[model samples]
Target: MHFLPHHLADLAALAQMALAFLALCLVGRFVGGRQAQFEIDALAGWGLLAALLTLWGVATTLSLRIPAAAFLAAALVAVIWPGRRPDRAAWGELGRLVVLVLPILAIMATILPSQSDIFMNLMPNAAYLVDHGTFPTAGAPDAHSFLPVAPYNTQLVPFLGSLVIGGFQAGGLALFTICLYLMAALLFARMLVTPIDGADARPETRPGWAATGFGILLVTLLNPGFVPRVAFAGYGEAPVAITLLFAGWLACRAMVAMTAGETGRTSLVQLALVLVALVNVKQQAIGMLIAFALAAILVAGYERQIGWRRAALAFGAAALPAMALYLVWRVFVLTRFPDGELKPLPFDEWNWGNLAPIFVSMGKVVVEKITFFACVAVLFVFLERRLRHRQLDATGKALGLAAATFLLYNGFLVVTYIGHFPGVMSVEAHSFFRYNTHLALLIEFALVVTIRNRLTPWLASCPSLARQAGVAAIVLALLVPVGFAKRLRFDFDQPQPVVRQLALQLAPELKDDDRVALLLPGDTNSVDWMLMSLLHFSAPRRPGLDVKPWDHADQAAFDEAAAEGYGLAFLSCTKGNSLGLPDHASALLRHGADGWEPVKVWPYPPVDPKQRWQPALAPGPLCRS
Candidate 1:
């Protein structure tokens, strides 16, 4: 079967997601509290996938059906469980917002590049999980080296959705990441909008739809530092940002619950699961989880919102599940590959000399966000009197959490840099700003909460202006991610020509046990990894079987393996002067005793033949890596 055209592919992806999200949200709605329903559902959606991936990662299970069946059963239980119904109006509002924004989201997902370590790390792992129904063990074919330890939580969307789609589609993650970003915006808006009623919602007062929308735009579109390309480009940081924001949000609730002399059970499953999902996303996430937890507990203690002993117990209870799950994953990894490459912790390298430069460079990233920090300063002013009186509120707790986490996580980064990246740290802190973006949502949460008192009243007094502002915000929010993301030049499907063309050639020749040598050494504009991925996963099965990248083998070795009946095939998409094959254009060659014989001769990817910007055709440069 042919791969569906790009547009159809996205539709197929969203269809699967729509089902899995419903199942996931049902469990979230039942087990989780009704407050911040969107946040609960969105993060729960992420959490379920994380759980499934963690389970698959830890278990030697041979069937994807185990995770899939568990989800269906839990969702079924959540459905049949007797419970109060959810807020219809709130659900309606969220539904309307999703409808308004989905087209733009779909457009963005379609453009998410099939590049970078996506092919090397994320996609291969995801494709393997979906195709094989299990993650790669110590030695699995078609597995990239990082599969053993690289966090596959980010791969969950595509993996889970592929269960329904019958093959993996990478667009699901971008779509879900955008959706998570939306939920984060809404959650932050709720934090601010509620204050318009002076921190209490009056029974007769209308819901602040306009003000909610207003806050969303401010937190999302107006925040100049939010780069869509980075956030939506299948990075670990985007999901971490959402999970971290949820941590602060739910932690605020826990603070409030403890202050009121009760357990924060309402938010615990979600909060704990959010943490569960967080620590599993990346190794750095465990550091983030600790940092945020410390900030929350410390702030709670300092604010005296609850008795110190009681707060500590409650906070520890909340963190218990996450810590336990993290340990489970650790045990699984250690048992599976005791001497394998898991990238030595705190790194194997140390550089005392780099400390000064790392410190200075990291500080500069903070300074560059002067406006955000300036907002944080104002928040401190707002909380000063309350904290001085030993009577802080959830907003104050959120500020404390974000602030402390900012300090702690970045300081964690310094240690990480000295270890994991000492060489790069000698000059500058690597990806400092990008790493800091994980806290962007929480920072904006504090920013919005600080100003909510004044902004809400101002908006309420002028309903016309608020309504117009909401409309403009909606338009801008939809336009901004697409506009900025396009500027990054990844907004195209034309780049898949090499992959699309190669898959057509290989599917007809290779069998289940056959191996293919991907000798297309790429520089800045073409990629062999992505080509291999497309060949392995783009369709139901003219393609869906595994084809390992045997790049290390040269002509002689390939011929050697061929003589031994390995049926080795070498493919080069580059023009020439590659892999000891001189004066030859791109071709698929079968290694044999008679020397390498051409199985198929093809030019380097020509531009998409269709050319028009229609559903069936892609418009752009021919072979963009």
Candidate 2:
């Protein structure tokens, strides 16, 4: 009976994720056109997220049912419509890849919610949304109630998932979002291996292209940060990063078409939708959006395909909706919650001394994660250009745009780190590494394309045995670093049985009308908080019971709680330490050289005495009214 709720919850969440995936695929087909399988996958993921954000905004402002109905209608139309289908060969290839990837996806989905960020803010905000159907106001009384008013559009996906799956199991949302990253990676792989327009029509080049693309895909998949690690961490960076990749991919396609003197209307519209979604996901993506716009204009001017007027109009048409949405959200926040505005760090606090260390650390990360493949690709392109005595082609032009964006985005990061300046450049300096993943991926994509374009002809001329050997060598070379990095960084250990037992024992002690104060240590792990929240969720009196951290509580607050007969519990306490509690409370808990004695705590429904152990809590002055 105890295990049933967990099973039902997982099943429900899985069902909801499937429905979302189907709806997204349909929407992607409707908006982006039926292109390659990988293209369709990328488009579907992008469209789904964009639609979800727009509907969520409307739902939060108007009514939740409206968005629900709208989504159902869209999904209905997408399902009933006769969409283009991929050929047998394409399906066969996709199936093979799926077989290879599914186990990793399953493991990732199962363990994702255990990530630390869920407790810090993600799960709490999601729980608030599930209970209230909207963001909490600044006036609400609770721990971290001020979070809702902050710039956190990233929470919407998990909130939406919680609505469908029940409450605050953001692991489900993370699993669904991972689809976007997988699709984007697959799309990059497909583009590299497959022949794009303007490719040499020579039949001999096909096999070499296939081999090269496969090798690149293998290397990319093996990257530690690419798969299960960052993908399932439930970081807001996942959506923003994937969206930027999609935007870059679309922009590349558009530039390629324009270079051939044709306007790629479908690609351009898709690009616009992606950019809008990017900004909504993370405010920092505004920089990338602007950089993309500049790249679009510059490419147009250089190629003279659509001319300056049409180019400007096209770029504006793509960016305006996103800009408008951002403006509206900004206005709403400022007007509704003026006091919730974030203050910039003082410029005087900026540590210029940290610059050298910051650069060195960032450079090392880049070299470890990105530099090798990027440099090789560039060198491949250079050698090809030199040997062939040819000018830059369409792929080369797109590469230029990607390279420029990469540089511009990194430059922005440098300025940002200097300005924000988190003190002491240790692993904390690497905190921003997640933000850089997208740019690094983009650079890799551009390089892969350029290398494919230049090397396919040369590779086609080589003997079959030599080509096979070369591909094997590249894969081995890439795997060396991946072996060292060992992609699994997260703690996969399940929560201890003692924690669960303690939570169950305390549930009956809680009353519907009572408020419970949880006094957590200053250095408490997020997992501890997550377990505590789970305990509260499972309590018999959960509906009216209020469980909160009392880190801000004073002596008077404790005295009042005791007078009112409220429940209080301390987690993992020891002698001589109050864990950030006030001095008066500290003395009570450590009256003797040894710590306070534990007392028996009862389980719900009164279990046998033999099973009961001494409670972690002991009576104290603060608790004696």
- For candidate 2, the lDDT comes to 0.53
Top lDDT model: 1
Q: Write the per-residue lDDT of candidate 2 for residues 1-625, one digit (tens) a residue.
A: 1221254445555555555555555556666554435434445444455556554653366544355446546656755565644345544555544444444444444443445554555556555555555545555534233245544445554444454455545455565555555556456556655654432212212223334335334334533335444555665666766676677667766666766766777777777777766776655666677776777666555555567777777777877777766677667667655665443347876666677877887777667656444553574565356436544456655566666676677676766676664555422345555766656555555566766776768776887965676567445434432442324324232232334455556566555555565543332344355545555443342545565554323444455555555445443322233344323222112112342222332222222435422222222212211
Residue ranges of candidate 2 with Cα displaced over 4 Å: 1-12, 34-60, 83-97, 139-146, 149-168, 196-220, 224-228, 306-310, 339-390, 418-430, 458-514, 522-545, 550-566, 575-625
Clashes of each: 0, 1
lDDT on C-alpha atoms for all candidate structures: 0.62, 0.53
Task: Find the 10 residues in a row with the least total lDDT in model 1.
Answer: 196-205
The model with the greatest TM-score is 1
Question: What would the per-residue lDDT of candidate 1 be over residues 578-609, giving only the tens digit for each residue?
Answer: 34443324556776666667776656534455
TM-score of 2: 0.73
Error of 1 at 89 (Å): 2.2
Model 2, position 436, has a per-residue lDDT of 65
The all-Cα superposition gives candidate 2 an RMSD in Å to the true structure of 8.3
